[model samples]
Target: MIASGCDCEIFEAGPGRVVRRARDGRSLEREAAVMRHARRHGFPAPEVLDADGPDILMERLEGPSLMEEVASTPGQAAEHGRLLASLLRRLSGVPAPGWLQAAPGGPGNRLLHLDLHPANVLMTPDGPRVIDWANAGRGAPGADVACTWLVLATAPAGPSLEGWRDGVLAAFLEGVDAAAARRHLPAVADRRRADEHISAVEKAEISAFVARETALT
Candidate 1:
């Protein structure tokens, strides 16, 4: 296996291809559809070759995830943050198809990657390519930005990683709509709080972070 996540494992399938298989045996049709839609709109998403049941065959991305890059070179956190912000901005411009479900909080025509974060971005020779469309849907762009902020701010991290999160977040907010993020933060926090994969400690931190951020805004 090339890598593994909470719900999936990536395995090299052949030259330029990899298979992402869900651990819990869920269909990947929706994820594939979202990726194809994003790609059709010129968004940077991995090319989906096939999706069947729990497995999605996609073009193999070369190089490290944005998170891994930041972890190794802390000095580049700000640069990566800007890149992330730009990616979010680009994604927000894509019009959502009717088949895509609406996310919590508000109705919008924009596409949203509810799980977007550094770990989901791959820094390739061509550019940054976004991966993992499982949580993608339709929502206000700000809500998506708020989701990214919440993840960066409250995800459980080690000492070194924790130290750099603030810097990355600050840089990212500078490039995006900070006010929008603040506006939608409460709803995002509530959604994250109910996530089954989130730890209790992280959930508590998310609540505190949301409260402080919203109050300041």
Candidate 2:
């Protein structure tokens, strides 16, 4: 296995492919469909090859994740942040299909990657490609940005990354509608709080972030 996340494992399938299988026996068909749809709309999502039951075969993305890049070279945090902002902008341009589920904040006609963070982005030879579409859905573009903001603002990090997080987040929000992102922050906060995978420490960080941000309003 190449890597494993909270509920899925990634395995090398061949020379240039990988298989992502869920651990809980849930079907990955919807996730596969979402990736294909995003790709069809010209987004930089990984190309899906085949999907059945709990496994999805996809083109292997080669490179370190954006998080790795920033962590290794802290000076590049702002630049990578802008890159993430650009990716989010590109995704916002893609029209959401009606069959997709609505995102947490509310319903809208834009593709929302509810977990778009540095770790989910692969800095590939071609460019940055977004991965892990399990939480994707349709919603207002601001909702997607809000989710990223909440994560960047609160997710647990090592001492090395803790200080740089704000730099990356600031650069990312500079290009997007900060007001709109703040508008959706509360909804995103609630969603994160209820996620079963969130650790207690992370939940406390999230709550603290929410209180700080909300007080400024």
Candidate 3:
């Protein structure tokens, strides 16, 4: 993929994943802090081998990504629904140090991986490895779920795509405050404004998903 943005080339590697700096020193430091905290709390994630400015060398994961696995299943939607919820819950339980984002940004007291999506999850032989902590921070847990729903809703679907998006989304909303989680467009919109740029269509889809989930919940 082409680079240059909020964090450019941020991923240079010598053998495995050697660096992740394109984002800058401050970004690298924050990510490193989060990674270290995750590792300490036993979160299945990459090890920060080194962190110097925007450069962050990381341990390479040795396994298939969740994106790859999802391609092979007829019931892929269901599988992803189950996997995403369980993993996020586990991540929430992992306590970061006091210096980290200790307080929730809003209602929920759980830590959130703002960029949670299937692409960031690697399905290793041992278990799932959550990657890409660039957008991670302390926030309501529902924000994370809202992000996931946005992913499913906005992901490209060809005429050949066979699964039901609604079912997959429902799978994601099976537990907790599924309704309130869906109606989090304002939060999602705010997040997009502060960080990455989600497409207008994608944002609209997210808004719709948020509404639908809110209604169904």
Instruction: Give the candidate number with the greatest TM-score.
Output: 2
Tell me the whole-model lDDT of each prediction, alpha carbons only.
0.90, 0.90, 0.67
For 13-69, candidate 1 gives per-residue lDDT tens digits of: 999999999999999989999999999999999999998999999999998989988
Instruction: Indicate the TM-score of model 1.
Output: 0.96
In model 3, residue pairs whose N, Cα or C atoms come closer than 3 Å (at least 3 residues apart or on different chains), thus clashing, are: 10-20, 10-22, 18-57, 19-56, 20-56, 21-54, 21-55, 182-210
Once fitted onto the true fold, the runs of candidate 3 whose alpha carbons sit more than 4 angstroms away are 1-17, 23-26, 101-108, 158-164, 175-177, 183-185, 193-196, 214-217
Candidate 1: regions farther than 4 A off: none
| TM-scores of the candidates in the order shown | 0.96, 0.96, 0.79
lDDT of the structure predicted as candidate 3: 0.67
TM-score of 2: 0.96
Compose the digit string of candidate 3's lDDT tens values, residues 25-110: 46477777788788887888788887777676787667776766666654677767778878877876864455556332365555
For model 2, the stretches where C-alpha displacement exceeds 4 angstroms are none
